[model samples]
Target: MKRLKEDNLKHFFAEETLKKYSVVFIIILAVMLICELFIFNFKWVNSAFDKKVDAEMTLSGINESGTDLKFTSDSATIEYKNLNEELKYLYFKPGSNKGGVADITLSAVDEANSSYFSAPSRTVLTDVKSSEYIRLRFSGEVKDFKITVNGMNGKTISKDNIGLNVRVPLMFSWIRFLLLSLTLMLLYVLRPKSFVYNYKTDLSKNWQRIVTLALVAIQIITFWNMIHWNTGVLEWHKSYEHHRQYYSLIDAIKEAHLYLDFEPSSALKNMDNPYDFRERYAQNVAFKWDHAYYDGKYYVYFGAAPAILLYLPYNLITGNDLPNYIAVFIFGIMIMIGILLLLWEIIKKWFRNTPFALYLLLSVVFGAAACLAYAVQKPDFYLVPSLGAIMFGLFGLAFWLSAERKNEDGTTSLISWRLAVGSACVAIIAGCRPQLLIVTVFGIILFWNSVFKERTLFSKKSLKQTVAVCLPFVIVGAAVMWYNYARFGSPFDFGANYNLTTNDMTKRGFVWGRTGLGIFTYLLQPFNMDAVFPFIHDFNAATVYQGLTLTEMLMGGVLWLYPILVIGLYGAFKKNSFSDRRSYRFVYFSVIFAVILAILDAQMAGLLTRYFTDFVWIAFIGTIITAFAYYEMLRDNEHSRRKFAGIILTFSVITLVLCFLSIFAHTEDSIMKANPTLYFTVQHLIAFWM
Candidate 1:
């Protein structure tokens, strides 16, 4: 019952002019580049402080002058080991000028000779509440120092911490300018040629352009959120605290000189392998987080695609590897692109009658927001599989879906470049998550006709299609298998045996007994909610069966979070409603694949939220396809049934908002714990109006 007419997205362009926008973007980028060059000449933009408040931390005294950070008071009088050298620095948590103004005044006290050295007071403003240390940078260190907080209000503002941090302004440095230039260049290439001009690229499509623009906007926000409060733990923390293993391996590749040997790596711990682990006399000891140690060489147990594709090559070209979070963030954006393309392809095939908004809705839900924010939560080694699967799986599937598209002359094009790319994507999908091979069922069903067209095993055109499609798989698969052999001495071994998991994977086997219970928990597990801001909580450990299988904390089952996914099985429930035999067959196969993946994960990988990434996408894709079919049924039949569509739209909007908020409020670990300042800032920002 929705209007058939579509909105022209031209109005959404920058001031209705693409050229104007490009020119302005170029100007800004040029300015940034010039500024970076000037910085290279001079030390900084300003001879004095840059007026940028990097951190806003509460005050605390250093217990032993450097290690444990327990901030205490706004003012501190401390004695240092060296009178003129050690105690000459102070820290700041910028003031939130809403109520009053404050500045941290430091006066170094020379206890032996009644002399003091203090830097000019720097004004402060509220910033993201992470601590930053400001060194006095005086000629010599002072052992005795006194910090005075000057506030306009007599109210004792709590903001103080003893200095153990000496921060540089390199976080947002010249490197950002180079990155900015790259971003601008890509934008230029992708910019709309002319809003009104129809071109070979699909950029001419009115709605697709809007969707791409929305993607660009979303990327800005996601990238901002990734590094907004990067606490620097990922820099060089020695332990397995977070994504240290990921970057540590990258650092090893860069400096260790050993192909994959981890030595001379960036770390707070000793990196020199004086023990000569990779040389003559060595031990077979490996670092934690699945770094396999075999014959004095350390091989990363995770997928080599990320390192080979992103880290190693990038480090070689740029002389350093980027933060793993940045890679995950970019991959997350690609996942969105893939999902968007997939949904668009689906709309082209089945839901051409539906509105463009519907396509975008399904795309955003399944592509970006599905799985309760697991993909973008934190860019650690834990995310490598989820990110890889999302990028390769969705993109591969999207490309496959675009295999057949209608032409302008009412004809169809069966031969699409996407098919070959999709074929290769499916092959890589197994490397990302070996279990995702189940999705290949959908692809097989998709090309069922093409496979059947040729009566012979090999035909001229069919052979070409097969070669184009299967070549990437053959090459990538061989390389992956060879990589395994090079590392673990077996082509099939991915070194999961040497992993530092709770239980030894080499010793672990399938827990078939847990399948029934795991299926129930994975599909029907109830979501826990509370009155707290982040209402969702972890699955009750009691609900899990008593077994030896491993599991991670889960928010809820797929069905509990998104119940509408059950519509994927609409064919079974409302038989004969689907007139399109091919579409019905696709849905049938998708359901089977979903079931297979769920069983595999529940029985094999264990019941974990992250594991849901394996099969939950099936529900997402199937739900959209089924919804469109149902939409057609309503449109062709009783118009009164249209209210159901309206209800779904209204409910979907509400649900998405709640889901977004729930991710923010997820219990135990979330934005609330990861960055308390961001969480409080959001709460306060919301509270100001609410």
Candidate 2:
């Protein structure tokens, strides 16, 4: 009888393990299938004008077993021979920049009938440099596909050329899906436990584990995708194609040509030359977008970090440059992760016993709204400041939080070095985007009591420690000032005045009259949704945002998208809701700055959606903290069903809206449109709209 009971227990254990495994396995399997079948898209480039080609398609030969197709070619003999049993789409991506001279007369000697039914194949492929999609479709049976290029000048096309990638129909290529599937599958089988975070730790550790596991997985996917994606040259040429000074800076660096005094310049028609007044002028030497023309050289007004960090290292390694789109993607993942980490710290600090699930949910909302919905769209010139600001601010805040960790005995250790490190991170705000320097105040809020002893203004030890924290910031600040001085001849002037943009920055200043409207547009403007794939359309609002700032059609203000923010404002004034006064003050401090910074951005930067990324994070974090506080009240209430339900329903609605908002964030201008197959596939799923 005892032996039979033991056997029964063993069976129970086996069944439970299978159930756990099955849940995870199903999720993994769904992801694998979706990646393989659903999320497939690619971007192709021409040898000329690859920078602007928006639409791309699949590699076509991937099947159930595996992808059996591959490319092997040298500079001279370009070949994509069919090794698969089926004939796949012949996808050739070209150029990285908008303009390049590429006239390739290719002799396409098809082995089989390279025709879609009876329709004859397009014999001549001309204007390969154009940004618009020109189809080179082939549907019939084809075996070997070889193209011997009639080279322009002396450079023959490489069979395995750069900037050209194989695209599938969705957000990823088939080859990419196959590769990711195999890698993830291998990982699952080998280290399955690590993929799922252990939730048995303290509330803090639980959130940490969840974030860490997620970070590893995303970094792996993002890194793989970054390398595999057909990103054009990530260099001065591609990145600074419009902003010419960056390109010229790299040229000046490589050539060691330091010229300031007497170079002949082209002035704008008959206007005085901005660079050298001695020659013919082109009115806008800065040419396009927002660039600074100084001393006969074009300078990017964005930041120096992109050049120093991304472009330089990429050049050293790949013999090519890194594009802002690819750079933003890589940094986007980091910034997203960093933002989550920052949120976790704030949540833990605000409410020590906050549930891990709630933390995760809040992080999800923040990630979906900030990272995926808004920031991911502007992967071009905007990436440098937007993503950079997010990264510098969030991680800087996170590092500052780590400077003090409470022990089990309730004693806090002051790690002065971390404070310095944190300051160092924030200091680079000078280079990337200084607007986020408001976040640095959180550092002071975190470190203030320590910096000042009880009943005294300041302490000697605290003062010394403050110096340590301020040291890195001072050094980095000096470096940025020096960089500016060397380029624009003024430490204080970071070239904003010199920008040739939609408005003249030299004449642009804070308009107190328009700021109220700017604030209205920043967070309160309504979103417009149309009957389209990307359902969210432009906001047709009568705005007082008459100031000079370039922005897409408003997709509603931040408040319209996330209404739960009111909970925080309500919680702030509630007596006895917060556990402690210090944390409560900190929350308000962050909230005040967040809103103030939004106003500052509206005043300085104007009414752009991506600038919302600068401050919306504070609103998201504040809401989460307040919601936690509000929940504590409901937990202790006599009859809390209606209250709890109301809270849950409100949160539930926000979450539900966010899920759709993240995907259908922008119609017509949606990244989903990049993958026509995936876009249409998902579009077809919703025939009710049709």
Whole-model lDDT values for every prediction: 0.56, 0.54
Clashes (N, CA, C under 3 Å) per candidate: 16, 30
lDDT of 2 by residue, 569-600 (tens): 66567647677666565557656766787788
Q: Highest lDDT: give the candidate number.
A: 1
Model 1: per-residue Cα lDDT over 446-488, one tens digit each: 7666667532113565566667667777887897788677677
> In model 1, which runs have C-alpha deviations exceeding 4 angstroms?
1-204, 219-223, 226-287, 293-297, 405-413, 453-461, 569-572, 637-641, 667-669, 684-690
Candidate 1 residue-pair clash tally: 16
